[model samples]
Target: MGTSFEKVHDYMGRRVRGLWQRNGKFYQQLLVEQPDGQVAPRRILLKSTTLDNCRIEMAQKRGIRDQGEAASEPLEIPSFAVCCRRYFDFHESLKHGLKRQTTIDRERWSLNRWQVHFGHLRVNQVTRVMINGFMQKRLRGGRNPRTVNIDLINLRQVLKYARDCGFFTDQERLPTEGVKPLRYKAPVRPLLKDEQFGLLCEKADSSANRSGPILADFIRFLGFSGGRYKESLRLKWKDVSFELRQVTFGSDGLSKNGKARVVDFNPALEAHLRIMHARRAPDCKYLFPSPQRGGKDIPASDLRGSLFAARAEADLEWVGFHDLRHFFASYCVMSGIDFKTIAEWLGHESGTALIDKVYGHLAADHKRRMAQKVSFSLAQQAASPAEQPAVAAVQQSPSAVLPLPTQSGESAATTALAS
Candidate 1:
């Protein structure tokens, strides 16, 4: 066996800040030559305030051999497996501070699932046929088209990386180019006005269950305010300035979208919140605490559970916790809350496009209201004083009048003839 040694490669690519950053740092990768003669390259993620030190430290962590490691037996070409590992490592390395690890984890899971399916094959072996076949297999097994499309997206990224690394020369396009994603139509089952009021009353008065009342109030708060589930859970007592009657959101624990919105408290919701506030611990900060008693915010599972239980008690069906969001917008339209204000409450981008796309029908009633207004305006125009004077003038004129024949003249002619 040749002088056995581990080889390391430091990828001095882009420098960026991430979750674990003091200031800025360069990323590193390591490849080891096993005694079995298989060369394996691995990425060791590292970030430091100084890029220079990060490079040096990355090299040091590569292995003990410093001398001919770089030149000795140029590290064997990495396999598809190694390539994907590097791709994720690169992705994690460039992660921005605002990016949530949950999102990264979800993306990583999708990528790795694809890898497990086909990472063993050579990069060049991947063809559109192979991709379509895989998708067909997944779809035949009852996977939703949306899921298959997600897998396709993850594969596209992998193939792109392979092309970039010169594994294949097909610069023309990705294998997924011709693939069309499945269409998903959002279900349109908005709560009727009476149904919404009934649900709220049920939540407020559910005395049978320990968790029902708190969960009910929280749900009602969401229904009334159009706040996201996580936003509601993350709400702090400080966020609500009862004096100003304004509720501000927390900067640190804002939702995944990183948006904070305030809702002008309706008198009803404000009263309910005040009652909940009185029960809140002075030091225990969160407006909604986990029933288990030790967490920053209530677990999503609890919220889901409470929602299901309340729905059961209220005999309401087909409405999700998020449907409360739709309910809010729909009720807003019914109550005459303007779309712009409703969008702001829902944390939507300004403009009717997204709002209309998601809840266009919710605003249908508004369209009807507008139509009614137009009809009323036209009716008033037809009966206005200006038109009335013209009608009176026509009625007063003889040319516009019709005369009736006189029956008395006919009767007098008949009498004269008899005489």
Candidate 2:
């Protein structure tokens, strides 16, 4: 077996970072961390040679330091099932990359289903055709493309590991080379309206199970803060800094992108937090302590059961915990908050990409009102200074220039032109 020594170059003849090519096949060099806090260089074969894929993998593997030191390479070739287990074993020993238990758990979930299909086959026997068949079967069985793509991702990682362990010869083609993820539009979920939130709180407050009031508080907390449910579940009372007018989302690297963020107080979030603090159980550390915690102190694991009841009573079957997050983001947009600032509050990266795509939907009335604010030309640019008064008057009295849009949404100018 040859050590990865060749540095790969893109079409522009520029040297790429941590990317290497040998014999027309591309591989990415990763610094996998050992349990003892030292990192070891492990060059893994890529499923595809495109720079985009390499960059995506690189981002996911960031933060592990590489000192250009080589690690002991595994020499064992195993079945797909064994490879899956070993893959997890390798991640378990890592102090850096794949360090988050949440990410590992998600990977395990995806790989478990993958192993069920390819477990009996040897690592080398897993081919592109078989992978396509599995994906087709999953889609036929009513699984969405997003989930199927996740399965493919985990499988690709195991295959890469198997290749590193000398499972594949140099001449054989990578099985995942031609496989593309299924394209499907992400559905835009409806946000929880202000009135609906009030109704939900009312229903929750009236619950007979004594669980209703807590559920109301949970709703308000999420609705105001735009927090992911899991992050909010772990939020402690001490994380709240009234002096700073903000609540930190627990320890650093606890968020989705693995960074701690403090949500500054809005009127609703401030009011909700204060109310919860006043009524909080004295011995509890978490803001929302579990009523089930008799002796052992712990936060409530979930509020789904009570949410189901309140949702039913409020007749809002489409509402979800994440909808509260959408509610916060959408309302922020409506209030003229910038996407970058909102993204910071929500812990999103890459500027306003995710914000503009997912949470930027505005209410119809809001959109219409904003549409009224758009001007195609500057007053000075559009006309001479002497004519500016007429333009200004026309702008101020839009109905005089052209009658307002009618009930059917046609302007009087259009009506006159038609006549």
Q: How well does each candidate superpose onto the true structure, as a TM-score?
A: 0.63, 0.70
lDDT of 2 by residue, 294-385 (tens): 98779888889888988998999889898988889889988888888898888887779988877555644477677667674664366655
How high is the CA lDDT of each candidate model? 0.63, 0.78
What lDDT score is found at residue 232 in candidate 2? 91
| Overall local distance difference test of candidate 2 | 0.78
Clashing pairs in 2: none
- Write the residue-wise lDDT of candidate 1 on 1-419 in tens digits: 23322232235644322112322323345566533347665443464445557656555554434554442223233455667776666767874544466765776777776667676765566577877777788889998888878877767777777667656655556676787776756456756465665665576456465666567667777777777777677777778888988676545554656767778887866887888898776657777766666544443236676667666666676667687777777777777677677777777766556766666675676676555443334543566454444344443552453223376553332333234
